[model samples]
Every structure is written in C-alpha cells, then in structure tokens.
Target chain A: MIQKIMFMNGYGVFVWFSFAITFVSCAIIYIKTLRTLKKYENEYAKELNKLSVSERKIVLKKSKVASQVFASYNKSF
Target chain B: MFDLINPSRVFSWIQKLINFINSIFFVVLMIALTFALIISPPDYLQSDSVRIMYVHVPSAWIALASFTAIAFFSVLSFIFKIKNLNLISKSIAPIGLLFTFLAIITGSLWGQPTWGTWWVWDARITSMVVLSFFYIILIVIHKLIEDEDKAYKAASIVAIIGSINIPIIKYSVDWWNTLHQPQSINLLKGTSSIHSSMLLPLMLMLLVLLLYCALIFLMKYKTEIIRIKKKNIKRL
Candidate 1:
C-alpha cells in the first residue's frame, strides 16, 4: 500500500546500507575460514606423506603427545 | 556420520553453505529494508524524525548483542581454551564498535529534533557512551598484547568484567531519574504514545537489523579463524 511504502522514507538508505556492509563482511570471512581449514588439511597430509618410516613413527608420537596435552587442557575447562 | 568428521570436508562444506545462506539472507534483507522504506509512512508527531528509530534501534541492539556475545565467548575461551572461541571474541570486537558508533551518531541526529539538543548526558546517553568505552577497551587490549595465549587470557578477563556493565546500561534509566524517555519499544505500554501503524515497521526493521548483525558476526568469526590458521601455519 502507498501508506506502508512511505513508512521507511529517507532512512532506508542508512538502514539498508549498514545491513549490507555487515552481511558482506561476514560472508567474506566465512569463506576465508573454510579455505584456510582446507589448506591446513592439505599441508598436514603432505607432511605425513613425505615422512620416512622412522620419521613417520616419531611424528605420530609427537601427534599423540599433542593430542594428549590438548585433552588435558580441555578437561580443565 | 563418522566419515563426516573429516575436517576439511566438513568445515569447508559448512563454510560454503553458511556463506551461501548469508548471501541469500542479505538479499532478502535488502528487499525487506527497501520495502519498508518505500512503503512505511512517516510519523505524524516526529514526521521524518521517526525514521531515525529504525537505524538507531538496530545499531543499539547490535552493540548490546556484540558485547553479550564477546562476554559469552570469553568465558568459553578461558575455560575451554578453544582457539575458535577466542578468535570469535576478538573478531566480533570491531563489528561491535562499528554498531556502537552508528548508534551514537543516529542518536545524536534523532536528539537534535526531539530533545532540542544535539547531545545530552541523560541516563541512556551516558550508559551508551560507557558501553562504547568498553568496546574500545576490548579492541585495545586485543591489539596491545604480544603473546596470543596471554592476550586471550587478559582480554577474556576484560570482556567478562565489561559484561557486568551491560545490565547497568540497560537499567540505568530505570534506576535513576533521567531526561531520557523510558523504553519506547516496550510491548505492554498500551499502544498509546506509539500507534499500532508505526509499530509494525519498527518491529520489522528491528528484525532486519538483528539479521544484519548475525551476518556480520558470522563473517568476522570466519575471518578470524582463517587468520589464526594462517598464523599457526606460518609459525610451523
């Protein structure tokens, strides 16, 4: 209705623009986070593949330690 | 379901889906905002000045919401040591500050016509100003600390402490005699001062604003996660 259309009036520009900025900024961030997570996974895989038999064992050991540390830390929470 | 725990697949898909949904939300919000603007009528009392509430209310809501989020995330980060939580709290800081800035500016603009002054240190105004200070302090603390773990700890403390102020700010007017009008957005006010006609658009605008905040907060949190991931990789 014509009556409803006039309700927002001149203020629509400010309201909409502000909302747009916030939305776009968030979307960009979200995409970037996923990309980084993918990158990390790829890097981890490559490093694992490149390790020698003995080195692989040592690396796994370190990972076990790291996980344990993380678990203990988590428990404190 | 066990296969779904594959970090890259799971997280990337979530990211993509969230981004897609957020984009859709943005478009829908745009349509709604434009529709409201074009369709809604100006107030008889304040005329175009009433339009200010649409902007002012949303920004205030975001400012308040952001602080509340930061406080909650700070608790998570401190107790759980979740890097994601810490990053989220840090990233949301700037967005919160931005909304607070908008709220103050729109408030001043609204005040000129309604209050006969551009600025007043009324209970609401003073509390909002203090809220802005808290946002700035959070940002400053985040920046000043060199060690990430220590910084997270310190900032978490600040965030938790600052949250105590939010209730005070909300109730400041109620607790003290003030020139600032009481909550206009209240539902139980008997629809006397604000007519039913005006309330509809006002509520719609608020929803749009809240959606906007959620969109921004999600985006900022994502960016922070990426930035931290990169930082960790670089260190390795």
Candidate 2:
C-alpha cells in the first residue's frame, strides 16, 4: 500500500516533482519575505533608538507606525 | 473611507493575521496534500498525472487573479492618486510572478507523461510565459526606478497595458488550436467539467495557496510600511 502510494503507477516522478517544486518555492519565498520583514522592523526600531530620548519621544508621539514597529521589534527579541 | 486601509490601521492587523494563518496553514496544507495525492481519483485519460492539476490550476488561477488585481488597482491609483493602492499593487506583483512560473513549470511536468514532450510553444503556454514577463517587468520597474512617483506611474501604465494579455491568456486554448485544454471551471457560467472528487482537492489546495499568498503579502506590505516610516522618522 505504501509503495503504491509512492509510485502512483510510475507517474510518481512527475507528480511528486510538481508538488515538490510548488512547495519548495513557496517555502523559499516565505522565509525570504519573513527575513526582510524582520530586518525592516529591526531597522525601524534601530533608527528610532538612534535619536535622543526627547527626539524618540517626539517620534513615538508623532508616528504611530514607528512606535508600533519599535514595540513589535522588541517583542520579537 | 481610504482611512480604513491606512497602513497604521492595517499594520496592527498584519501580525494577528499572520499568526492566525501560521496556526492553521500546516493543517490545511496536510489535508490538501492528502486529498491531492492519495485520495483523489485519477483521470480516466491522464491517469495519476492528473494530480498535478491540483497545484497547477490553482497557481494559474492565482497568477491570473493577482495580475488582474494589480492592473485594476494601478488604474485606480492613477485616477484616485491613492498611495495605499500602489503599495498593495507593488506587494502583489512578486506573488503573481512566483505563481506564473510555478504554473508553467508544473504544466510542463504534467505535459511529459501526457503530452509526450516537456513543453511546446502552444498558445496558452506561450501566453502564460508572456504574463510572467509582464510580472518581471512590473517588479523591475519598482526596483529600478529611484523616484517613487515615477515608478508607480510607469508601473501603472505597464499594468494597464499588460492586462490586455489577460483575456488572451484566458481564451488562448479556445481561440487557437493549442495542445492545452480549454478551461474546465468557469465561474461566470457556473460550470465545471471536472468531477467533484477532483474539484475538492483543487479547491482545498487553492485555499492553502491563498492563505500562503496572504501571509507573504502581509509581510511584504509590512516591510514596505516600515521602510517608509523609517525614512520619515527624522521628519516626524
């Protein structure tokens, strides 16, 4: 039964290859996109931290995205 | 209101949505894979190779749908001058490109056992290749053009023009005597030549892929928002 499922009547190569490629590609994209998102989130937090406390406070007050990103980035770490 | 889709509003939801999808994605994928590979009945004609349709068809559908969405949003952005819509289009382009290539590759894999050849310059296949090129051009434009406004304008034009090929891709199998089969599922007419057993797996796989696309798009969109915010931090 296991062998039958794997072989798929000798067409298994094509079938498995199709499914494998589709999934592998999806995984690669997922990882790369995740990495890029994390990098940007880190940068956003880092850039905000580069400022003095007063300036950081001003930014956090003015830009909701900066504050949210900084918080999210901290959560990740 | 446009405020409904503002990045600040959307950003809050992205993480929650990502976590939600991550929680459910693997389970859905396993179900889809089981049905697609082990449970679904094989074609009377094509045999076990028909399983490829579960992936190929969904990928093709997504590729086509993504481009249509990008083109529609591009036109809307140009008319409404909505920066958010442009960001949405930019995020969608890579996803479209990835699926287009997947469709072509899997179709080729499906072809070898069934068509006796890996590939042929059939009308449908060639048009899919063309669609992929359009996706590449759209991405390249965004990356190469330094000026944000110019990139979006150029991309909008390209998207608007590239959309013309969409219908061609859809009808290519019918219009030309291509080796590719005509569309089995037609949403407008509410018809499908495919059996329910096969359709179930196809739809399940589609759900899985759609969830995956959503996860990727949200991440990319979040990155774009952060990059913009980082650039503007000093000004803020």
Candidate 3:
C-alpha cells in the first residue's frame, strides 16, 4: 500500500514534486510578508522612541487623527 | 449598514476573515490533495500524470484572475486618486507573477510527460509568457521610479494596457492551432469535459488556492500601508 502510494504507477515523482514546489513557494511568500511587516513595525517603533515625551505625544496624536479619518472613510464605504 | 463600517473595522474584518480561512485552508488543501492523488481514477490516456492538472489549471486561473483584479484596482486608483488602491495593485502584482510562474512551470512539467515536449510556443503558452513579462516589467518600473505617485501612475497605466493580454490568453487556444487543449470547464455553456469525480477535487483545490491568494494579498497590502505610513511619519 505504501509502495503503491509512493510510486503512483511511476509518475509519482513528477506529480508530487510539482505540488511540493507550489506549496513551498506559497509558504515562502507568506513568511516573507510577515517578516516585512515585523521589520517596518520595529523601525516605526524605534523612531517613535527617539522622540522626546512631548514630541512623541504630538506625533501619536497626529497618527490617531489620521486613523480616525481613515476609519470614517471606511465607514462611508 | 455600509456607512456603519469604517476602514479600521474593515481592516479588522479582513484580518478576521483571513484568520478564519487560514484555519481551514490547510485541512481543505490536504483533503483536496488526497482526492486528486489517490481517490480520483487515472485518466485513460494520460494515467497518473493527469494529476498535474489540479495544480496547473488553478494556478493559470489565478494568474489570469489576479491580473484582471489588478486592472480593476488600477482603474479605481486612477479615477479616485486613491493611494490605498494603488498599494493594493502593487501588493498583488508579485503574487500574480508567482502564480503565472507556477502555471508555466507546472505546465512544462506536465507537458514533458504527456505532450513529449517540455516547452511549446503555442498561442496559450506564448500569451502566458507575455503575461509574465508584463509583470516583470511592471515590477521593474515600480522599483526604478522613486516617486510613489509617479510609480503608481506608471504602473496603473501599464496594468490597464497589459490587461488586453488576459482575454487573448483566454481565447488563444480557440483562435489558433495549438497543442494546448481548450478550456475544460465552461460556466457559460454549463459544460465541462472533466469527469465529476475529478472535477470535485479540482474545484476544491481551486477554492483553497484562491483563498490563499486572498490571504497573501491582504497581508502584503497591510504591510505596504504600514510601510508608507511609517515613511510619512519619518518625514514629519
């Protein structure tokens, strides 16, 4: 039974290999995107940390306002 | 009801949907793979090699579908000058290219066994190659143009113009003498050449692949949005 599944009437290698490559590619893309998100989040957070207390508060406020506008725009949709 | 939804809410909703799909995508994928590989009977003519169709067909469908989607978003971005729409088009391009590449690769693999040749310059194949080139050129242009607005405009224009290839790819086998077989599944005619047993697994695989594409597109788009916002914050 195991041999039958693996050999697949002698076409097993090609069939299995194709599916493997496709799935591996999908996984790679997913991981790369996640890494990119993490990288940017770190960069942004680090930059925010560099600011003085008052400056950081002001920057955060601006971002909050921008997000509010975005939220409203989304609601309008 | 639509007015009640905001961007944050929509974003959160997409995240939730993606998470939900992610949970089930693998289970469905395994089931589909098993059905395709073992449960489905071998083709009378092609034998076990016919299993490649499950992957090849769906990837080709997605390759075409993604370009159509990119063109639609490009139009929206151009008309409304929406940065988010442009970012979406940008984010989707690489994934579209990946599908196109997979289609070509898997097609070549299947062809070598069944058609006795690994590569063919048939209408369907050539048009798919052209589609991949269009994607590469768009990516290159986006990289070369440093100005985000200019890059977006240039990419959108290219996307819209290159979209003409999509219909050609769809109709190429019909219009020309080609080794590539015509489309097996036709929704309009309510006809499919595929057996019911094989079709079920193929459809399931297609669904899983499409959900996979959606998950990737959303993740990439979210990252792009955050990256852009960070850049603006740094400038501020």
Candidate 4:
C-alpha cells in the first residue's frame, strides 16, 4: 500500500509536485502577509506613541483603528 | 450607509472573522487533503495525475473571480468615487496573482504526464498568462504611483481594461483548438462531467482555499486601514 501510494503507477512525481507547489506557495504567502500586517501594526503603534499623552488620548478616542493597533501592539510586548 | 462601512466599524469585524477562520482553517484543510489525496479514487484515464485538478481548478477559479471582482469594484469606484472600494480591489489583487501563478505551474505539472509536454501556448493558457500580467501591472501601479488617489484611479483603469480579457480566458478552449480541456463543471447549465467522488474533494479543497483567501484579504485590508489612519495621525 505504501509503495503503491508513493509511486502512483509511475505518475507520483507529477502528482506530488503539484500538491507540494500549491500548498507550499500558500504557506509562504500566508507567512509573508502576516509579517507585513504585524510590521504595519507595530509602525502604526509607534507613530501613536510619538504623540504627547493628551494627543495620543485624543487620537485613540477619535480613531478606533489607532486604538486597536496600539492596544494590540502593546499586548504583544 | 457609507458610515456603516467606515473603518472603525469594519475593523472590529476583521478581528472576529480572522479569529474564526484561524480556528477552523486547519481542520478543514486536513479534511480536504484526506479527500483529495487519499479517499478520492484516481481517474481511470488520467490516473493519479487527476489529483492536480483538486488544486489547479480551484486556483484558476479564484484567479478569474478575483480579477472580475477587481474590475467590478474598479468600475464602481469610478462611478461613485468611493476610496474604500479601491482598498478591496487592492487587497484582492495579490491573492489573485498568487493563484494565477499556481494555476499555471500546477497545470504545467499536470500537463507533463498527461499531455506529454511542459507547455504549449494554447489559447486558454495564453489568455491566462495575459490575466496574470494584468495582475502584475495592477500591483505595480499601486506600488509605483505615490499619490493615493492617483494610484487608485490608475489601478482602476488598468483593472477595467484587463477585465476585457477575462471572457476570452473563459471561452478560449471552445473558441480555439487547444491542448487544455473544456471546463468540466458548469454551474450555469447544472452539469458536471466529473464524478461525485472527485467533485467532493474538489469542493472541499476549494473551501480550504477560499478560507485562506479570506484570511489573507482581511489581513491586507486591515493593514490598509491602519495605514490610512497612520498617515493621518495628526488629524486623528
């Protein structure tokens, strides 16, 4: 059974290659997108931190996305 | 109505959707793999090579659908001038391009054994290549153009023009004699040449890919939102 599954009647190479490429590509893109998202979030949080406390408070209150990024970024730390 | 889609309201939903997909994605993927690689019997003619269809078909479908969506949103943005829609088209472009590349590569893999060749510039294949180039140009438009509004307009125009090739890709097999086979599943005519056993795995794999697309789109869209906010921090 193992041999049959592996060889697939001499077509295993193509079968396996197709699956491998599709999945590995998906995984790579997923990791890249995730890293980019994290980097952006971190940068956004740091930008908020550059503001004065009152200004930061005002920004956070006015912008939910800003608050979310700041809160998530701080949580990561 | 527009207020409902405002960044803040949408931001909270992105978190929920991302968490939900992350929880379910792996389980669905495992099930899909089981069906695609093991449970589903090999084709009588194509044998194990048919397994490639599980991924190839879905990738092609996603690539075509993404470009269609980008075109739709692009045209709508042109009419209504909604900046938000541009973000959606932008988020979808990379995912589409990745799938387009996958389709071509996997199709080649499937081709070598089944068709006895790596590639032929058949109508369907050539048209799909055209679609991928369009995706590349759209992404480059976004990256090269510095002005946000200008970039969006340029990308939208490119998307609209690229969309003209979409129908050509779809009907190319019928329109021209090609090594590529005609579409086996037809939702419009409610017909499928593929058997149920194969169809089940194909659908399951599609579900997995769709979930993956959603996750990526959400993350990219969220990043875009944060980017806009970050740029206008002073106003905020």
For model 2, residues A1-77, the per-residue Cα lDDT tens digits are 88988899889999999999999999999999999988888877988878999999988887778888888777878
The segments of candidate 2 whose C-alpha lies over 4 angstroms from its true place after superposition are none
Q: TM-scores across all candidates?
A: 0.69, 0.98, 0.90, 0.98
- Kindly report which residue pairs in candidate 4 clash with one another: none
Please name the candidate that would achieve the greatest DockQ relative to the true structure. Answer: 2
Q: Residue by residue across B103-168, what tens digits does model 2's lDDT show?
A: 999999999999899999999999999999999999999889999999999999999999999999
Clashing pairs in 3: A74-B7, A75-B5, A75-B6
Residue B102 C-alpha lDDT in model 3: 96
Model 1, range B41-151, lDDT digits (tens) per residue?
677776666766766777787889889999998987788676666766886887788788778877777777667887988887888898889889888886898887888
Query: In model 2, what are the clashing residue pairs, if there are any?
Result: none
Error of 3 at B156 (Å): 0.7
Global lDDT scores for all candidate models: 0.66, 0.93, 0.83, 0.93
What is candidate 1's TM-score against the reference?
A: 0.69
All candidates: DockQ: 0.09, 0.88, 0.37, 0.87
What is the C-alpha lDDT profile of model 3 across A1-77, one tens digit per residue? 88887787888888888888889998998899878865765666666667787876777676752343344434545
Candidate 3 scores a chain A TM-score of 0.71
Interface RMSD of each: 7.1, 0.8, 3.1, 0.8
